[model samples]
Target: MTATRVILIRHGRTTWNASARFQGQTDVPLDDVGVGQAQRTADALYQELVGTDVRILSSDLSRAAQTARALATKLHVEVGLDERLREISAGEWEGLTRDEIVKGWGDDYDAWRRGDVELRLGGNGETRNEAAERCASAIVEAEKAMDSGTLVCVGHGGALRGAIFSLLGTPAWPWHAMEGLRNAHWAELQYTGQGWRLSRYNVN
Candidate 1:
């Protein structure tokens, strides 16, 4: 059987990102730097994957959708938007900066940084397991749309990280080791009948 390749790209930087604020599900758009990043990324990916049968998928959020649109334009394809690809909701912590969060929920914030998946960021945010399950399911479902080819998923950092863990067939524990995806960078994985293999991770 042919393998299915998934290229997971994190969305470009938003104003919130530059400000070091947690965007969560805020639907923030890409900033100027982010726009440029998306354009450059699209150009690179176009040269790399345009020769193949490529499909583009993105989170419905503006930031991710915008980045996906750039790639779609390069490949001359439509962007498939999926909410399940959205970032993990941070609840009350959505708009806060790291410093602010530290001040408000010091212990919980430290716990989260220490890899406690259940220590919700705002005491009401989506748990790590929940985000991982949803994002992984979305990726698997997206793969079903094509039999054998490349699927580029433009998503948020948190959700994409979750997807990476789930798709790699490992428990979400020790997630701290799986560094977050940098803006406009990507991780590539191949899915076979036996399992999924991470070939390239956090590549620009």
Candidate 2:
């Protein structure tokens, strides 16, 4: 048996998110609204996935793990942790806002925002391609552990988006066509035997 589907879910929002600050690999927990979102999302997912073979995986970060725990509790399954699912490391820019980053690294930030895949974020962070590759690898690893079941991967926005870009084999850098996932939103990908097909994206 092989995994036929993948559900990529972004963790709930944090105070940092509300402030437009970069959380990159930070262990920030979910805010109250985020907790509510997680519960609602878990309820919806439970309804959709009940009686189906499901496996829940999550980033080791607190925010993502917390969100994953909600779903896991609903499904009565243990959440598996994968460090590779962590958000793109922003290094010096971890807690800074976009404006702050732009103020400090104006040229580089501009290039990064323009979808320059080669730019190392925060002067010492992971490149877009690098993050994408690692995320893709983590997804594959999760798939290998499952057999013909829907694999739910809970993670940060940037890393999960990078996973989608890599898994879909998109040639375009930065994948401007794909928007970021809202807090607690999810994207679904199906394996058509021939290749992976996006069944749904940014679904709440």
Q: Pick the candidate with the highest lDDT.
A: 2
Off by over 4 Å in 2: 171-174
lDDT of 2 by residue, 56-76 (tens): 989999999999999999899
RMSD of 1: 1.2
Local accuracy of candidate 1 as per-residue lDDT tens digits, 1-204: 343789999999899999999898998999999999999989888888877888888999999999999989878899999999999988889999999999999998888788776666587889877887899998988887787879999999988888888888885559788899999999999987788889998888
After TM-score superposition, the amount by which residue 179's alpha carbon in candidate 2 deviates from its true location, in angstroms, is 0.8
Q: Which stretches of candidate 1 lie over 4 Å from their true place?
A: 1-3
Q: List TM-scores for all candidates, in order.
A: 0.96, 0.97
lDDT of 2 at 9: 95
All candidates' lDDT scores? Answer: 0.88, 0.89
For TM-score, the strongest prediction is: 2
